[model samples]
Target: MTDARHIEAQIYERLNKVIDPELGRSITDLGMIAAINAVGATSQGDGDVPSYDVTVHVELTVEGCPLSQTITNQINGAIVSYPDAKLTPHIEVSSMSHDKLADLVAGLKAERKQNPFNKPGVKTRIFAIASGKGGVGKSSVSANLAATFAALGYDTAAIDADIYGFSLPKLFGVHTQPTNLNGMLMPVTAWGVKLISIGMFAGADRAILWRGPRLQRSLEQFLSDVWWGDPDVLLLDLAPGTGDMAISVAQALPNAELVVVTTPQPSASDVAVRSGLVALQVPMKVRGVVENMSWYEHKGERLEIFGAGGGRRVSDQLTETLGYDVPLLAQLPLDPDLREVGESGRPAVLNEDGALRSDVLGRTFRELAEGLLRSE
Candidate 1:
């Protein structure tokens, strides 16, 4: 009937607004809506409007998709809320046919052929958080900074470039493996940031599954195989004692800027200079340095726990050696909440509502993020 056809068409149009949380695309656009059938089930009485029952057939990309229920629920809401007449929704779901999935993946791959960040006119601002050694709170800075960027309304993505010592998964509290669509992988989004880490990969042979001969391939694989979709900012939490990883990041993301993290002591600050000096070997720019644990506040006095001026020393050394100004960006406090709440799967810079904390440490990271976005 014309009424049925018109209602079905209207339902399809409504579905365009329902996006798949994992893909960040509409189910209708992804060919997930196999069919939509609508019919007048009954009328209330004489002079009363009729009620229609709409049946939606959905074909998902993967079987047993964790978000399948979410999509169906959205579909139900979209149809049931139609104001012209009363309506009920029935959603039937199934996995996509092998041929359909293959075609979809191939089309997507063809559309996105190589590393999206290296595009000629890419707008993504990439920052590789590096350190001379471990335990300098480099990953902590990376996690909080990415969260801050997202809180500031940027579509942010982060790669745990520290393959061997991957911790972003734990820091961000991501438990589910990435949704693999054919050969392409979807990054797990948490705290409003898209994230990818080897630690989040599943399967028994997960350790060696995504790597090749050189460890650099892991970084490249994260760039090529993941569906990033052109984020406004991309943060890479690089491994400590960096040489290969820094070089790899430069080669992979040509526009990436390096942000070095160091503590307020001689031993950590000395090697921190070497980490920033990596800009000499590659074409990457050395963004300013962040000094972590500069001081601890107890009672009414400030205590320089690790000694002061370490961040400034690294900045001065890098500026002199690299012939560019590498300023001291921020002096982060030695706050215990950074580790305690961070271990609980959320960045310390953010509150429970995912808003940037208005405290000292949070304000410092917000300024760091804003400064990174400014032109030199």
Candidate 2:
């Protein structure tokens, strides 16, 4: 006969494997496994097996978590692994109180501070996508690149670090604010990518005319206040131009690699080169260049709408100026359908054969994601 205590221990061990999908921590460690009561059969009936009724109380961060079903299933599956247990586990799901959740968030923040990735020990591949000017598709590229990486099964997030010009929420079609659980802010998920942006907090068209100090404070809060769960890749959509916000981003993520975006025109490249130089002020590496609107495909011929070689020119200048090889990561052509998809609040990568179909640019984004992962 199996000892009841032994079975209980085994059950606890199994529960450790059941992690909170969002938090990336086991329910046992997170204090989400509120209670585990095992009621054993007092006596065995003739030709009948004994049974144990186990009740597991789970505390969810949000009142209406989309992952509640998944958590329940995981808990039930884990409880049944004990031999001769005759498993009948009753799972109770409840939300943590605001105060208690606040404490949890505090603890998580402390843990992140101590985490190697957050520290200088572990390397987190941070990419800042900056352009010389707005409407150059920097935000769109950041959003799509993040989605592509997440689709490839990497833990990824795109921070709308452009505090004043936040647009990630619209691009990813996420309208909800991050839920606070035990003080930790759970990032909104869409297209398998976790996202945090000021757009979620402020209205899309609402103007935020904050000063430099307030902007810096907001940026710090975005990084420290939110629970990012130690992502494998973090893509930052930096506001265009070299300003205080860009400087703050560089300071916040010291190891961030830069990918300057520009059109094919020489003037665009010239302006983009200045932004790349600003990245150098923080001494961040200029990874490569992404040239948007390089050309438009008319029939089978590629028409150079924005002129050409701007991406190459920027890459060449960065390599020469920085004393390192800065290659052109990709040249994204002008796809009207891609712009339409963005306007419709859906990423082109997820739609099959859509405007942003699986073409060279798409492949390049995937490759860029893979390369970053490998570098990390």
Candidate 3:
């Protein structure tokens, strides 16, 4: 028969492999596994194998959390999969007390150390999508790019740094506000991307929300106050401007790369180049340029409704001025479906199931996402 001590130890080992779905950490390590008790069900040694009734006490971070069932199922599987013994699993679920939850959040924040991404030797690839002019589809590109990154198996997070004119929440179809854990906020996950935006705080009456001087303070709050974990890619949808927000991004995230978005018209491309020139003033790198609304495919013909060569012109200008190759990354087609689907609360690159679509639009975004990472 398996001894009580042995059974308890084995249960812990299995539980260690069962990660908390939301936090992406081991339940045992997170202090979620409150207790484990095992007692023989039948006679101690009826035969070669022993059957035991195992009860596991799980304390969740929040009550009625969406992922609680997923955590419990994995715990049950861990107990039932023991090879040397036959185990009947009984799982108990409960939320942590007010004081305990606060402590956990405090410890996590302390360990994370204010701003995790800006810390030295951080592995996150930060991309700030900026444009000199609005109505150039910068936010759409950011949303689609973030979704593409997530679909490509990279942990992705997006911040709508355009506080006054936020659009990530709408384009990504996120209507829920972040979960307030103690003082830290949990970013709402949508389209497989963890996202936080000022739009999410539309109905909030908190005074902490941005009022007038939103350039630096707002960006700082998004970086420090939100729990982003360690995402592989972090995309920021900056407000359409030439200076203030871009300078703020450079000051806050020194390691951030700038991705300029523009259209095929000269009017947009002129400002787009000036926007990328902010990298000259700051210590940011001009990663590349994305040309949205380049063409519309209809009836087996490519129509350049928005004129042409704006993306290439911006790329060439940035490369010549910066003395480095600022390649034109991809030319995204002008599809009404992109707007329609996005208004429905989903990125155009992803399907209703949140998986990457198999169509041309998806392929273009996938290539763009891969190219950005490869060049990094």
Candidate 4:
């Protein structure tokens, strides 16, 4: 016969294993376990072999939370781990309303203000991938860089801030929208990277024609609404040029490092330098320049079809204007295989080894990722 103390200890041990899947924290720590009662068996059961009814009261963070069912299952499973336990475990799930959620947000804001970046002691590195023009492979680079970071075992999230031009979804092949839990949006994982994009909310045929203020509001919603859960790195894929979205991102993530992308042509570099200048206007620091479509290999020769010296010119201009050293991070050559893989909804960084179309581009991405880590 199990003693009362033994049963209580068993209950505590089991409950310790019950983790809130969304928050990735034990229920006990989150204050979700309101009560734990071990009811004695009735007269219908034998007294020698006691039947225990464990009741756990759970408090959810948000009303209409989709993860409530999952939490209930976990709680029930935790209570049934005892071998001699015969009674069914009762689980109750309740939620806090909108007012409580607002209070929670206010508390978080206070905490953030106390320790910006919420690192408390550690630093949170933010990277912003920007370009002067669209279709310049900026999204692809952002996705692959994020994938590489995750592959190297870093907690990373890639945010598609390009509300109108969201291509990260198709590149990563993430089809499902994030599940909402306790008023928090959980990011979907792909290629080991957590991702959120406006594409998940807006359909393909629907046009995103919002002006500046509306765009800023949406961006803020994306940042605060989603539960990023303290990632080590947050990569932002900004829309091309110095638009409203870009300004909003600069203002919101003031500590973000700038990585400008451009082609090898002088005209492309000229525009790229202008974009870097715009970032400077926000008083944001420019990290370096990345030259995409630097060249293409045909047969045995390197063909500079887009013209050369664009990356160098942009880097030089940034260094001169910022009065700081701005190096050329990487020169990503043209790779048809990369384009095909991206079109097929598979980023080259996650593809099988040696299966990548352009080994040069792959190496460049890996090197860039290494540089990021080294800088940190």
Candidate 5:
């Protein structure tokens, strides 16, 4: 018979593979595994198999969390899948005491330092999605592109840096507020992406930010006060305008590249080119332009409802003005389903399963995501 201590050690090893779906870290690593006890073992009818009752104590960051069932189920699976023994798991779940949780957050913050992204040689590729004006689907593009990047197997995080006009929480259908550990906040994971936005907070919670210096301080706090872990890609959905927010992003995230969005009209394209010109003022690089609502398809015929050539126009202007190859990255279709699904709180590029769809819209976003990453 396998010794109880050996079986207990094996159970801990199995638990190490069980990750907290929210934080994307192993339960053991997070100190969530409070205790494990292996009780009396019994032999099965087969004579060769051993069965044991295992009790696992889990301390969640928040009590009665929405994902508690998922974590429990995974833990149960880990115990039952033991090769040498048939284990019965009893998982006792509880929230960390306030003082203990505070200590945990403090240690994490001290280890992370401040604003982990600003540290030297960080691997995250930061993209600031900006538009010259509103109604050009900038937030939608940011949501879908961030979803696409996450679906494509990249560790992704998106900040709805739009502040006064935040929309990522709505688009991603995130209804739960972030769990506050002491004063630090955790970004809610939705549609396979880690997301944060002003919309997720109540008015009383948001009022805490009112004391800061407007946009710059707000973005700085989002970077420093949140536990983003180490994402492979970070996309900021900036407000539709020029100068201030762009310059703020440059000052805060020195490595962020700007991706301007515009519609297919001379009016929007004119302002779109000016948005890219902010790169010349700040040290930020103009990644490229994404022309949203470029065309509508009707009965197999491509109709330029918004007028054509705006994307090309902006691309040509930026290349000439910026002295670099500022290409037109994508021209997204005027799909009604895109808006419909988005209003339903999911990115239109993803299916009901949160996986990237194989349809035309999905392919277009995938290509755009690939092109943007390749440019880096």
Candidate 6:
């Protein structure tokens, strides 16, 4: 019986590493492990290696939780890692009772409160991607940058702040709705990044994305209602235009810095400066400018598809106007794969296996991400 008790203790220790994907807390700590029963040696035990049959009872936050399989697989992996003992594992998972779930949520809210990022001492780096107009690839830039951060092992979360033109759900390939426990909602995890978008909720593209009757209120909902456990970075894909969303974000997230996206053209660069100029009206910072579709390589020669100096022009203007050095952070080439692969729900800078690519686009994005994290 001492041996059984010892095995159970070890199992509990290992389970501390198994985090609930949505809640971002260990299942064991959430009081999910109701019991652990370990019996004597099983036939599968290697000769004298003291093998035992262990059953772990798991209580999930909700019934038919979409990520139950992922949680189960991780628990199984944790159990089988006990090489000292030949442990045959069985995990019995069931939904927590209504009262228990309510208590757990209440406790979590009381501890962390709502809108966790705005609190003092929070280290989350928030970036709001903006543009003067549509078709400049702001959402694409937001999706790729967020993916690059996640692939590099930074805990990352993104909100599709573009209420009318939400595309992050498609770009990140997220098809699952956030699991709602009582009133609190969990952001969906896809491509190693935590994402929240109305596109994933109502099931239709344009119709569902329009739920944000008030853009500012919707931003608040995404901030307060979702359970984001203090990620290292938070990115907002702002709508393409100089409008209320930027001010709303500045008011809600005082630390949010703006990263303006512009194409290589006088028309785009001219208005791009206005988007960055929103900082003049609000207390947010204008981080830098990203020039998209700067050039296209055609038959061994570089072709200036949209014209060459728009990114620099916006950067120079913003720097002079904002009285801070708003440098041109990156110059992205026009790659067809950025659209095709993105339409397939994967960021172009990442490989099929979800690893950061070693190609030019990937390297450039990595540099951009590193630049953003660097000190001024």
lDDT of 3 by residue, 46-70 (tens): 4567878999999999888777898
Prediction RMSDs, each to the true structure: 2.6, 3.1, 2.3, 5.2, 2.2, 2.4
- CA RMSD (A), model 6: 2.4
Q: Write the per-residue lDDT of candidate 2 for residues 180-242, one digit (tens) a residue.
A: 665457788887788888788646568888888887887777777677777878888999999
TM-scores for the candidates: 0.92, 0.89, 0.94, 0.76, 0.95, 0.94
Question: Which residue pairs overlap in candidate 5's backbone?
Answer: none
Q: In candidate 5, what are the lDDT values of residues 141-230, reduced to their tens digit?
A: 999999999999999999998887788998999998887777888899998899888888887235333422677777887899999988
Error of 5 at 168 (Å): 1.6
For candidate 1, write residues 178-269 as lDDT tens digits: 88888889899999999998888764224543342476888878998898887899999998976577788988887999999999999999
* Residue-level lDDT tens digits of model 6 in 1-376: 2388899989999999999988889999998898888887644433557788899999999999988999999989988889778788999999999999999999998888778889999999999999999999999999999999999999999999888788999998887888898999999998999999977777545453333338789899999988999899999999887777887899999889899999999999998989999999888999999999998888878899788899999999999998989999999989888999999999998999999999879999999999998845
Between prediction 1 and prediction 3, the one with superior TM-score is: 3
In angstroms, give how far residue 167 of model 6 lies from its true place.
0.6
Model 3: lowest-lDDT 10 consecutive positions:
204-213
Q: Runs in model 6 with CA error above 4 Å? A: 41-47, 203-213
In lDDT terms, which candidate is top? 6
lDDT of all predictions: 0.89, 0.80, 0.88, 0.77, 0.88, 0.90
